[model samples]
Target chain A: MKGFSKLLKKDLILILNNYFLYVTLFFAIFFILLVNFVIPEDTSIEQSVYVLSEYEEGNKLIDYFKEQELSIRTLDSREELMQYMVNDFNSIGFILVDNQNVEYVLQGYENEKTKNLLALNIENMFQEFTNQIDIKTTYLVENNTVQKIPFNKSIVPLFLVMEPALIGLFLIATMVFSEKEEGTIKAYAVTPGRMSSFLVSKVVLLIILGFISLFLVALTTVGTKANYLYLAAITLTGSIMGSGIGLLLSSFFDNISKSMIWIIIIAMVLSLPFASYFAPNFSPALIKSIPSYSMMFAYKEALFPTGNSSIIGNTCILTFIIGIVTLILANLNIKRSL
Target chain B: MIKVNGLYHSYSNDDNYAVKNASFQIEKGEIFGFLGPSGAGKSTAQKILTGLLIMQQGDYTIDGKFVDFKKRDYFNKIGVSFEHPNVYKKLTGLENLEFHSGMYDVKTEDPMNLLRMVGLEEAAGKKASDYSKGMLQRLVFARAMINNPEIWFLDEPTSGLDPTTASRIKDIIKRKKEDGTTVFLTTHNMYIADELCDKVAFINEGEINIIDTPKNLKLKYGKKLVTVEYYDNDRIVNNTFSIVDEAERTKLNEIINKGNIATMHSQEATLEQIFIKVTGRGLE
Candidate 1:
């Protein structure tokens, strides 16, 4: 442990002197500025639902929704709803002529799949509400409904994944290659210091870097609203996993030049979760199986939690194990190769 | 302080060995020079002795403890100066030594003192990346001594340097030997071996061909010759004659006793010549 502290001290100095400190700070500031200023606050493309009743039975159908206090806008006339939908691309209009004949009017932008999904969802709700009104049983709202995530704020999870998680893979590899190029790695082999200590120290340094980036980006973008301790835990898991993988891959090659392709390849593969993060329905079982997918969602829970905080616990536990395994493999390879 | 019995190393896990059936012993305070050209087994042997390469098919004991290279104590008592300068390039000379000083569990020499010993005190604060190749070599040499090792392994310690710096380094090695540090010196340069080694081994093609003190090898294989300088046809002429042959000895004596003789000296086989005679190959 004492030896580990000494190696950590040396590695910190190397990272500081190599200008990586400046690079990380620069990137953090850039991301903070980007999230806060460059991206629009509400890029929400979710169109509002508009409806109008023309017959007496349609009024009963409208009353059912009105009692529920949904954001379903009720207009005076079908033409009025159509005008609102035409002017506002964020709106979709519905006309309940007699409940058996319903009409949906759009601004002509939604895809066929999206239109069908929206219609199917409305039809299910229509059926449920109509059944409830016929039976006349009062329904109670659930207490655990999470708040909606704003469009710009939703992108922060991707930033965490890219900066403190994915970017760390390359950073740790760079540090390893720096030591290899300087031949200090072989110098270390002759030392009484344990190789495990040497490897763990590198991971610790990367975690420190990761924490700094996380704090700067989070505070500037999300302010003091996040679960900081949970954020820190997720970041810890991410850095270990990133640095461990970087070390493992680097152990097989002699220098960064030979390993750069594979490094980029792994990073790219790990980044496949961003697809699911942006479009949740796009998630296939394969992408969901990736650790980064869980890490991305876990960071979301930490940053802007929507009550499913258990994801953070599960992701941290699983990634921590995987991280440790990679670190062990990296240690063995370095012992054999270096 | 160091003993190896029939060490064998095969990188491919097959019968083709980089070092085969090598055995040697170095007593406390004696300098054992391992002499061989490139691709010979000197490096493989030195690496094994220094705990860089694991002992595959042999027995090794350092300071009377059977060597376990995985043990921290194996490195605690030994130091290695590589042929290549392998120090932290971003660190200053002093910082490099100081960092290496921290790796050992034993008491270490002052980093500044090691720098002074290596004549790098003036440039101690300069980053090693900015240092010359010789300066970097000196820094690595200084680092190897930071622990005041009981056994020191030096490979081509003075391969590149001016005569003055090389002599200073050689003097340090001599002082350390006097202080009872066992030295395993590997180099292709015969001059260093001829000057420093108490006993030297000549190895080639993964095997040790000969091991003996330089003086004994000279006596055993050297041809005693006398180079005669004398006046011939109104100009100074030079000729070499074997003193052991009766006829050549008479001629040499005749030249020596003559008034025309200007200068004469005895000659013996050099270490390189003896190496060629034993291994049938030259040091590259």
Candidate 2:
């Protein structure tokens, strides 16, 4: 254990002395800030609805659309509404015929499904307007505070997961290649230091750096809402898994540049969770097969739990198992390469 | 302090043996030189003895204990300086020594003292990457002595250094020998072997051709005669006389008495010549 600590200290010093660690940290913070501030957040599905009428009923209809969180744009005439609809593909035009009826106009290029959905919603609004019935009903609103997370905050875990995992892979590759190029790895073979200690030290350093990166991203984006303990656990698991992958791939190459191609390939595999995040409905079982998928999912649940303990528990278990298997494989490969 | 009997090693199952039927022994405190050109099993043998390579077939013991290369304890009493500069480039010289010294349980000499011994005390705080080639070699030598091991395995310890630094390294090796450290010096430079080794072995093609003291090998293979150069007319003339012949000895004396001798030298073979004669190959 003492030897392991010494090795870890030496590696940490190496990492801190090099600019790679600082550059990675800078990029992590920059990305988090960019995601939070630079990119506009889409809070809700807001579509502009143009109301072409000057009547009191038309005003009521505009109020109703506004209540539904739609942006209401009032036009002066039918010709203006048609011109606006032709020019703006994303906006729907509402032509009020009388107090009892209305016409919904969509652009020619708009999808049929979106056009139908818009027509149906307008029909319901006209029904509520003519009948003067309070049709607005709230369900499951008591003690079920469904906090609407911003797009930036919702995707923070994706970046956090990717940063540590990819950095872990890059770190191990550079470390192994550096020692191999210098012939210091062979020097260690002649010393009293065990291969296990050397490998463990590298993994531990990755875990530490992984935790720091996770903390920084979480703090900057999610703030106190993120479950720190769960974030740390998943980060450690991802780091171990990443280090294992890096070590395994680095053994095949004699230098870091050669190993970078494999690192990128493995990174693409690990980044499958991002695809699953952005397109949840399109997720395949293969994406879930990726180790980072479980970590990312578990992290998301920890940030916003829906009371599904079993899924999180299973993800944690699966991640832990994968981490262990990869770690063992990495140790074996490192020993053999040395 | 070291012994090997019929040691053999092959890098792979289908490859030829890198060290074939190689065997030798060294007593305590003796600087035993394994002299051979590159790819002649000198490094393979040193690697086996230093616990870097495991012997496939044979028995070897160091300090009366059989070593298993896979065991961590096998390196407790072994020190090795490889032919290349293997120190961590990012680490200061002091830190490199301290880190490696922490790996062993033995009491290590102060890192600063080791640097001082190598005339690198002022550069102890500099990163090894910034060191010159000679300075890096000195640092490697200092690192090898950190544990003060019973057996020292050095490979081409002075390959990339000025003569002054090389002499300093040789002196340190001699001092280690005086301190009872068995030095297993491996180099293709026969001059270094002749100058420092108590016993030297000539190896080529994964086999040892001869093992004896440098002086004994030279005497056994060299011509037992002296050559005399004198000023004859306007040019120099040379004469050879056998040291063991009575009339030849008188002729040498007469040349000296004539007092016009420009140069005279005994025709003793150098270790390089002796290596060529024994192995039918040049050291280079």
Candidate 3:
């Protein structure tokens, strides 16, 4: 522990020199504006349903769709429906050749399950001569009628997952890569400094930075509505885990450029749960298995208490265990290789 | 004081070794030069001694005790100046030294004093990243002595430095040696080894070929000779004569007596020549 404080101080200076604080502040401001102004207060991923009809009853279907408040667009012909569907990855189209026959035009990437669901929904919608989606909808937070987080505020969980919880993955890698490039790791090797102290300093610096980012974005977006104490515990554990992964990754590769492929691959894989965050019903077992999946929901629970305090405690415990394991593995790898 | 016996190391972790049965000793204040070309395992031996590489098969001891690099106190007693300059570039030269000084538990030399010794007093406030290569090399040399180590490991300490700066670094090393610091200097530069090392070890292909003082090695492997340069009929003529051979010694004496002799000097085989003579290969 003799040089641990100096090592931590050195890491802090290096990170700041890399403009990490400025970049983090920029992200904080951007997220604040996004939650407060850009993303609407009452928004959802309600896919637009475009309708194309050759029959006269199509005009009646539009009115029916409008009355039900289904997000629908009317196309003049089948060509237009195909054009729109081809261009819009998120939208589905219904082409009605006659009153009895309706074909679904989908963007090619939709899987079999989604195509079948869309077919069934189309069938159920137009069984009574309707042209588009006719599923009964309920607005949970419209006009604050239900006890629910607003759509814009609900995005806080995903932001927390991406920023404080996982930013350390790349930041720590960058920090370690910088030291390697400078050849200071070799200098560090000869000193009386402990490897555990050196590794711990990096993790500690990231945890501190994570807290700063968390407070900046969370306070600006969620404010007192969130349980700050719980957020701190969860973010601390998440940051430790992120830094551990970064350290383990850095141990194998000499520099960031050499390790960049894996860095991006891991980053993209870890961010996969963000899709599930916005699309709750889209959770497959794979998405749910990601730690961030539970981390996102944990952030949500901390922001908006649903009497599920167990979520916060469970995530913190699980994350702490993962953080400790990865740190141990990283330490061993670094000692053996670096 | 240090002793290394039967040290062996291999990168492949197999029969092929980088260093084999390397052995040497340096008494207190003695400068031991590990001289070899690239891939000759001089670096591997130095790294093992410095604890950057673990001691795999060796009896490497300091004083009367065995060195355990894992023990923190072992590092406190030693310092290393790497071949390539490696300092915290974001920090000022002074700050870099200060940070390194803090790593040791022992009383350390003042950062400013060490910098001053290396003629980097003015650049003390400049970030290491902004330093030129020679300036960075000087800073690394300064940082190494910050701990006031008893055992110092210096790898090509003046490799990239200009003559004046390299001289300054050499002067500092001599001063450290004078202060009773045992120095392990690793280099392929034979002139440096000849000028500074009290004893030199010539290694090649992972095997140590010979170890002795530069004078003794030169005497043992090289013929005694003297080079004579003289002005004759408005032209300069150079001739080398062996001092040991009766006929060549008489010729050398005649050249010395000749008043027109512009320069007359005794010459011995350089460490580089002796290395090649012993190892049957050039250092480069």
Q: In every candidate, what fraction of the native interface contacts is reproduced?
A: 0.70, 0.69, 0.74
Q: Indicate the worst ten consecutive residues by lDDT in candidate 3 chain B.
A: B251-260
Q: How much lDDT does each candidate structure score? A: 0.86, 0.82, 0.84
Model 2 reproduces what portion of true contacts? 0.69
Per-model B-chain TM-score = 0.93, 0.94, 0.93
The weakest ten consecutive residues by lDDT in model 2 chain A span: A329-338
Question: Which residue pairs overlap in candidate 2's backbone?
Answer: none
Per-model root-mean-square deviation over C-alphas: 4.4, 3.2, 7.8
Candidates sorted on lDDT, descending: 1, 3, 2
The DockQ figures for the candidates are 0.59, 0.67, 0.51
Candidate 1 residue B281 Cα shift, in angstroms, is 1.9
Which residue pairs in candidate 3 have backbone atoms (N, alpha carbon, C) closer than 3 angstroms, thus clashing?
none
What tens digits encode model 2's per-residue C-alpha lDDT throughout A1-338?
Answer: 66677798899889988765796688778987787788667756556677887576677777776787766888888889888777877777778777766777766677889778877877877777668776567886567767777776787777767765776788787888899899888888788898778877888888888877887878877778777877777777777777777777777777888777778888888886688787889678888888778777778877766555565677667766766787677666664455
Candidate number with the higher TM-score (2 or 3): 2
Give TM per candidate. Answer: 0.86, 0.91, 0.83
What's model 3's lDDT at A65?
Answer: 66
* lDDT of each residue in A119-217, candidate 3, tens digit only: 897677666553443468788655543366888988888878777556778888888887887889878888888777888998898788888888988
CAPRI accuracy category, model 3:
medium
